[model samples]
Target: NLGSPDERPALYRERSPVEHAANLDCPLLVVHGVNDRRVPVGQARLYRDRLRGLGYEAGEDGDFEYVELGAEGHASSDIDQKIRLFRVLGDFLDRRLG
Candidate 1:
């Protein structure tokens, strides 16, 4: 790790995905587990909201999309949930790269 953001402000800013939102040229799909303790869902929500503020849209065929899974922690425990997440990711990539 580069160290905590408080200790390395410049490096943290450079590494933060949210800081480069304006430069995004491709579609984005942000997925998060609401029950996540490590990196809370709010962080993902903030990123998606920021993207939307910068003129990104949210939809299956839009420039940006977000998915929140309930009852899921840092990682989902259910195999079905994992499958769904992968499917969504695959579809997102296909639509973007096709």
Candidate 2:
């Protein structure tokens, strides 16, 4: 509505490559905060969906991982996760990539 399709062709052209590069078949870890206000969690979710659509694994058993830290706000700025979460993530990655 803001801009016609033709008016945004350049925008699409510039972003397509980044999206395509992200969709490659490889291991991906996406860690985020549920309360992040800067970048909506849905954006990460959409990216995960796109990567999954591109034939990447995206599940507990897949190459893609999504972790949502609760009440952590946008970043780990000062609110770090409890030790258990770190242990869980470390163990997960160790088992997966190790």
Candidate 2: pairs in clash: none
- List clashing residue pairs in candidate 1: none
Q: Who wins the TM-score comparison?
A: 1
Q: lDDT of candidate 2?
A: 0.69
Residue 85 in candidate 1 has what lDDT? 89
Root-mean-square deviation of every model: 1.9, 5.1
Residue lDDT tens for model 2, 11-90: 67566533664646665667777788987777677777777676677667877787777776675655247564676588
Stretches > 4 Å off in candidate 2: 1-18, 21-23, 77-85
Error of 2 at 54 (Å): 1.8
> TM-scores, in order shown?
0.83, 0.63
